[model samples]
Target: MTANPTRLGAIRTIEASEAPAAFFDVTEKTGAIFGENVFSLSVMQKRLPKSVFRSVYATIQRGEKLDPAVADIVASAMKDWAMERGVTHYAHVFYPLTGLTAEKHDSFMEPVGDGTAVWEFSGKTLVQGEPDASSFPNGGIRATFEARGYTGWDVQSPAYILENPNGNTLCIPTIFVSMTGEALDHKTPLLRSEAAMSEQAQRVLALFGHEDIDKVVSYCGPEQEYFLVDSAFVNSRPDLLNAGRSLFGAKPPKGQEFDDHYFGAIPERVLGFMHDTERALFRLGVPAKTRHNEVAPGQFEIAPVFERANLASDHQQLLMSTFRSIAKQHGFECLFHEKPFAGVNGSGKHVNFSFGNGNQGNFLSPGDNPHDNAQFLVFCAAIIRAVHLYGGLLRLSIASAGNDHRLGANEAPPAIISIFLGDQLQDVFEQIAGGGATSSKQKGVLSVGVDTLPDLTKDAGDRNRTSPMAFTGNRFEFRAAGSNQTVAASMVIINTIMAEALDFLATEIETSVKGGTEFNAAVQAVLAKVVEQHGAVVFNGNGYSEEWHVEAEKRGLKNLRTTVDALPEYQSPEARKLFTTYGVFSEAELESRFEIGLEQYVMTINVEANLTGEIAKTTILPAAVRYQTELATNVSALKAAGVDADTADLLRVSEMIAALRAGIGALDDAKATGHDHEGLAEAAYYRDSVLPAMLQIREAADEIETFIADDLWPLPTYQEMLFIR
Candidate 1:
């Protein structure tokens, strides 16, 4: 007669929905709030002595080695700026190899002799921090007894003020490393790879008769996708809380099948959360540019304009943190797990990347007549060659256990890594492969069947959402990145591979020209050779197509289907050579990442499997048995009264109960077997055995969900969680 005790979650969620949202007021304009909390260049210019400020600014702009003498001055300026704004503490924030941010906060109040504290922040403190090295996942790079990990300031990424209800702290972005110089975090390799790529890019530019070229920094604009569910629903499901996904929920009758939710109007509660989150991001100097409903009912996405890759990666981590805190305030639990809900399109972080130097704009830009632009063609060829040579590494970069649920699902890219140059670019490459590119396709105006509206010029190339890497107008959007992953890994791999490819092409061009071939002729020959050898990696067709998978395998392109399959490629001889060549990651550092990834994959699946078994035995089974009892008792009475009673309901319940119990037993067995295994073998066991058992449990549990009464179902239904306010 009454709602289940677990209904408290739903009640709380409803109440939260009804509560009025607190608004963030933007009193003036972009100039007023923009970089308000950030220790930006403008902030430094105002606070520091002009000479010191310029020294720091020049180092940042030109990628010069940091002057140790200027560190004290900059730290002093940074400290003064923070203390004036009521900041009492500073945190050296670093992104560890675990794809998460780690920070160590220190007090500014160093006690003086008199029982009073003096606000002191020195260059030594600012430049270096030592956190427990053994605590973080290091892929066996450091022993447990080894506790010396260092954090050094990444001067390119500006420090920012982080606010809490209680107090504020200044956050400095830094790179984490081991004492032996192995990268203990993502940022170190990212910065090194950027430098390597820039050096080669400069060489290529010099060939094109350019002199004023600053360091080429990769720009990243990641569109983040996530699901939002009420605290009530999230609390009711242990799977959502523990595993970050619905382990046993059945598909809603009306899921995203109608495709109505894609780009739909935002729900009021969710919209308010987005507004507040964007406001907070703006104050942190993040340029959030887009937000909208995603394909699934509860899914949403937010994007920012591209920033330099290193800063963007740091901001991305900060943005995810912002989403969690801001959504909680609005009574929503943000789910960054790739597939939070089964039977719906999952999430991804589509990383649109392009690189640029000081005045030379976007290097990836293949202009109107791409064939005529030899410089653009060479750059484009570098990407084609890079993707071809290290396609496996590219696939490896985005692989993870969470992402396994999303990729190859039609909604996302296939496991096969390939480039999509669109029709226009693909054609040019085809022509170059045959001999040389001559003419290029041009954009034409579209009337849109309306006279009042101005005619629009359609892009020469249509967008392909299914492609893992697609060349948009000016950038290659790496669409396969998991929503929960750090872009640093992907960017680092991209930079290293591109550096190798660029160097290889430059050498070929130089050798040909030096041998008395015309400069333009040498460039054409190199592009032709690159395309002829690597063009198989470029496919503009639907990557989701079965034929493409077959063709890809035939073409010898690697299809790294899971984390286990992809991670081993990270330590391949070619991969080691590429990273080492660029000074991005040493052999030890790269192997360490491989080890860490393997462990993470094993750990993630083991947890999910265990949670699946626990939830099935505890939450789901109890509900099923109670409902079965009611159905059985009623049927028995009808049978005793000599009326014919259908046994179908009882039989179905009995079969499902058996299946559920069987799944739980199977998963338990699988987990035990997985634990007994070692290294990649253990990860393989989880991917092969453990995942199947979990799926079996989910299948039976989901079936039982349909038969159980609404009130008897303890957890929130997919219907209620996805559609209810």
Candidate 2:
């Protein structure tokens, strides 16, 4: 019998595919539609009374607590604005530990003793809602019988309307927590960490003679990389649907070796998808700025302008959801898995991070001459000390089973957490370490040989794409974050660590000033001390090189290469003290996160191992056996007809079929061991035993795919899925 026609039919469907109807022209309506769906400050000002507006504005812009007395007025205004835009229901949207957006919706209609319903959104309803706690992964924060969780309104993040063809819902970004007011979502810790960072940052600012500063915020501009596959192909691939990646497909003949796909022209269909996605994002007030092809075929990237970390986290979730929704409209499936395909460049979200208030601008900006700027040097030194002291936590923040496939694979940053200060900044820091820095490197002008072109300004140093954290002029880009992960976790760790570093430096400077040292002298002394003690984490060399790994080990940097290894860093004494000191996370919350990380890792591998075995046994093996029978039958016919037949194809296919069956048995055996262990031991077993068994099965299946006839192949080939679109 022949194999299923799904793969070939999918190819035909793609060839006959037509572009969806055009969304509104973005260039013409960018300004008009931007933030139109969002119930922003401008909307509140128009709807609320003068006093009410002032109270709400103070909470949003100044990070002040919202006055409870004004809650009713604000809720009424918000409901009226949303209902005007066709919103019949409202949802309190929260980010749970699952790293996905969770929301519970309630209709605005209420009965007033009549058949008809009236719209009612009171202050009490707007401030909080209850969602089942046990249903969500809480790292054992709640038991099965205890199902109470609260969603509290987050005044800092703005509310927006999400559109649907059937109806629209007003979404209020909130924080999820247990009944005792412990954080159970990503947003709560993120917000708490921001407050911690701001408090310490303000203390440092006072030493620079600044007073009464506004609240400081960490800003993030995350560059999201993903691949677009035709929906038909995605539907046919079981591994892609279940595991979010290809478990057995062989590499295509043409990969990203030519490097021609980088920044290449976008496909017309994908461009239409982008237009629709950007249009939706604009209405939600997400400032998506750049779009282009990535280093691999079918891979693309979108970058947004920096926003406050809390808002950026919310917008990042919305951005991903929007992409997924809009891609379906254009007949594509957007994949955010870190490595969706084998032997290709994986996706990563490079989070560009910096912190400052509106009055002070970016604290990390070195300006024209960094050596002469004492304030910038202090902030820079703070980052160095923070990253050096807590490199393991930094690594653990981005660790996940999905990211493990990408990290240390040469395309992404290696597992050793290190900072890359470009040549200019490296020179200035070196000078500070030796004594007082006297000079800074300046940018040079570039001249094209062709006289017709204008002279270009060149940066002081070349960028290292391999660096995990690189200081690009203004901000440090965290290149290790997975494309599918929430940026909040990374921000939480960064904020908490920086708070400790800043507090340390600020106290030292204050103590020295009290000891009769000059203000400028005190600043320089603290900066020098930081550089001497914590400068080992700074590296200007290639992070992908083997030599750098050796060098890092020599410098005493811990290389946590897997999720099992990295997740335990959360329970380290230093991590506990840092989070508890800053009040970002209680010990219970910290322990909960560690358990959740291990649980998620173990579950991820278990699912993948099950899928690999099922697909190999049910799909790959059958296809291989069928092809082997055909080859054997052909040889029999040729010999019967008195003609010599080549037996090479038959022999190879038979060997692969045997290997596939044996590999499946081993995978099943490895998976059975998982029941015998629990927690870290279980995760370690999946990593060491189950993962290797799955790969063995994949090797046999992929090898068989090369020999099996195309029509007999059950799954979609990588060549078809990757390049057909």
Candidate 3:
């Protein structure tokens, strides 16, 4: 049962062991070691011919096809750089539909005629790789008999070196698709969505005299929030070890109630981990920009600077994987579950998105007068129309069993998708909606109460965390993404939906102009039509309130509350039309995604349900019965001795013990009825029947923990786990 000793290298494995050594010696002798392992622009420039380098750069920046001739040069450069860094193997790293990264490593060694080997990597090997599709979750895209899957290099994302004690491998970011040309991974569809957005956005930009721009990319900066618990405590807690979250922990008496954890000083151990993570990220070309304590105890957030959506999503996956590895070194376990702790704030990945071209021109940028900026108004209206038309798709994009526990809770956005424009932009949107002409407002410089204070320029509006989607200056922060989700799914939906909306706007504007309307009038007409039709999506109020839910219902917004409710919308006719029209996903591909999502939901809940039953039967039930027996015996002995024990306490303890047994019996009954994983029925069964039983069992177990003696409690308490750092 021991792990293979060969897998353990020079780095000592922790065993009945203390925390890892304080510092890792990442050398500075190669001061340029920061990106020395990556096949980056700097490496390319040094290794490639000037013409070849320019061609590759053009392909990456402009989204043009890579020249076949230049592929060999790029491969040579990548191979040489990787070999120099002690890499003996290479992998086509991809994000599969499983919502995690997948890779197949192959050694670069080639055999010569006589007992000798030479390292070799060719353009064919670097550009494309074939891995079996049967083993991966393909959602029926590829049959079991047809096992071919292709990994095409995404040159836009640079290749990096992944080092482990076992070996060093070069990882090329790639897109995965089936042999039949259907997308089998998250990245392929994301790239298609990006392409669709770029084409339409460029057309929109051309109307504003930005003809020099070849493409416009949607950028994302996802703020990832997570919690860290001591590994010892985590391992001891069966629920957390199996579920990635505690299923039966009583809420700590002190849990984020005083707003003390928010922005509090970081613990030294956590800070050390953060520092190490950031350093690793920086060396890998990830622009990690912000780090801070979050509202919940043991929770924190790390945000990166904005990059093109494709690269941003790729980096997010890498960051999460790296975080897990680094946390282990720091004697911590990183929990990305949307709701890891009860009665406290949960984690969310806040996605900050914007549209821009190569010239650094943001389409959503409001000039001196946002109201009068016709181009900005048009782009903003496009977003409004897209969100309104496809709110269901947006909801489905973020739907998952884990996130179901977070959304509509105080910590995260409500299930309803509504826009928050703040006071200033709300006024502008309303003015346009009312068909009133708007004039530019004069810029005001703020003067301090004293002359010693410097004059300051102010932003137009304040932030609203209540909004599911909020326009924060230049970007819209989509706050519904769960911390554990791959950013690709959400970004793909946003990009494709916006692309369709922009295309609609462009066609309408062009038709108006052809029909003798003036250019300005046509633009205004498009904006007005968009505001009239989709303005219902805009709400600048508290979404967490009951009033907002009723208001949303009145406005006809669909509130799909859970994964079971939201996921079916993905295969709706409307979704099929939208995705297929933009070429983001074929009908088959969409159906496949729906199947995969549903299966994943069922699988997640089933695992949690099984884990709950195991912990309850093996740990909780036994502990509770033993404690109850001891209490009963003590009470009986005291009564026989004519000494009055606290009868009330004994009766209360007996009552809870009875209730716990009932809950255990109910859980057993639920488990006996096995789940049907064939269709939506399975999802509904898990959500309604199985989940309620799980919750009931947890409630009883948690109550017992609160009353039981510390020595009798078989699991780590929330107080110990949450405050142990």
Candidate 4:
């Protein structure tokens, strides 16, 4: 006699209601509260002895080995600071290859015979610790029975306090390794790659007559995008909870079509959430510099200032964790999936990267006269050669189940990797290839046509949103990284590739100079060779266009359109040789990573398939049938009552009932057959067969959704979920 009304009703209530008033007071001075929870360099300087602090600082800055003699003093100082801040426990935090942060906490208190406790922290414990690493995904490095793994302190990232409702814990960033010494985590390889990259970069700098060059580092400033939805909406859909995306929702009636949502005013509820999130980030010493509404309803973006790649990677993990934890407190579920809702803009973490040592800033920066700036030209040429040689590996770095929904979607960059140097550099490089470059283009100032507004100095070129990698004024922005990923993989791959390319350039120049050739002639000769061989990867046009894709294939560029197509490339002979030669990864590690990527893809599709079959049978099929029966009953009653009624509704419901049954049967059949194979074959079955069947089911179910009355609909509509604020 009645239909349950909860999903839609809850959404309606939230939509019509105003946001809750602030439950807590906010501090106005952000600087006053900043770094309060972090054990930063300043804190270490104040707490440790002068000699110990200087030694530690040198190790941290130059990536030198930590001295054993100083660990005791440093540990004592750290323990005192943590205990003073009411911390009773400490954890060694590490990054596992499963794209997550891992930590095991230990208490600081040790009981004495006199019924008292003493807080103790030792240098050995601070430097290294053993954890049960069998459970972590090690890619066959350690068997299930062999569970030993080590965690070594990463002094580059600072320690910070993580608070719970009851207590706080000290979290020290560390690198995790398997028992056989293979890297079981992303940080270890990333750190190694950084060291290799810096050595080669130093040699290249010496050729340009720059002495006293410090160790170089790759910097990353990632811009994160995410969507926020009410917890009620998220929990109601089992697919969302299990798959981190909505597996079965019809396209919303109005979604991002007018472009009004981009840079739109923040909703009151969302503003409060942003405010609290930023304050928490600042306290953790995460330099979150920008936050704004993005190009879709309910989507937002947060960007931070650039930092060293190692610290940046750690901070990214902390940032994602912070977003999720804080979202729960605000009654929201933060969606980091590449595409949560259909027919809306997906989220991507645009990673801006560049390299430099302490003496010179930003080697990618094209100075006022880039043609005359030999140093910038050398580094820029190195990047071009690296990308051309390793474009396939770059694609593999971002391969994942979630990102497959975003890349090549027209709104984001295509699967093809290319460099977008601005017009000014493009012209210079063209001149260099032809013979030599002359003068450089300078930026011009423009008036706003109003006396009150000042004139703006516009850059020589505009930013390209459609390129996978675009050269911003001082950095290259990699726009294809999915939102949920750790930045380690992308940066590591970039560093290794750059290392190889830079070595090639340096060797050629060195040999030429030894042969009694002029240095200037040697530099120009190398640049000309680089442009002639590797210049095909540079493109300034729209990457999403059809013409570019066709032209790219003709130019011999790879178009790895999906994870399945691209993941296998990671084990290619060229990729393996590059990694091994540079000491970034061994062959076994490469094989393991490839296996992990394939396994993840297969499992992800399997879950979505199972949920699709179950939801269609348990929820969708019954709903459609009940509505069909109701319409039949009404039609029969009208005929018995001798009143004519429209037969159109009855016919419509019958068609949907038949389609739903047929779609569900097809999906069940697909899942039953696709499981017989393993490795790439099994992944292929899911991609080619099962995924298509799942889509068919969604198609029929969405058609049924359009006809069902609002009260009888089992799932919340996209309109309500997206626009309900």
Question: Quick one: best TM-score, which candidate?
Answer: 2
Top of the candidates by lDDT? 2
Candidate 4, residue 246: CA error in Å? 0.5
lDDT of 2 by residue, 178-224 (tens): 99888999999999999999999999999899987999999999999
Please give the RMSD of candidate 1 to the true structure. 1.5
lDDT of 1 by residue, 290-355 (tens): 999999999999999999999999999999999998888777899999999989999999999998
TM, every model: 0.98, 0.99, 0.95, 0.97
Q: Which ten residues in a row have the lowest lDDT in candidate 2?
A: 1-10
lDDT of 2: 0.92
2 against 4, candidate with superior lDDT? 2
Each candidate: RMSD: 1.5, 1.4, 4.3, 1.9
lDDT of 3: 0.85
* C-alpha local distance difference test of each model: 0.89, 0.92, 0.85, 0.89
What is the lDDT, from 0 to 100, of the residue 431 in candidate 3? Answer: 77
Clash pairs of candidate 2? none
Clashes of 2: 0
Model 4, 315-357: lDDT tens digits are: 9999999899888777789999998887898999999999996
Judge candidate 4 at residue 615 and give its lDDT.
90
Question: What is the lDDT for 616 in model 1?
Answer: 88
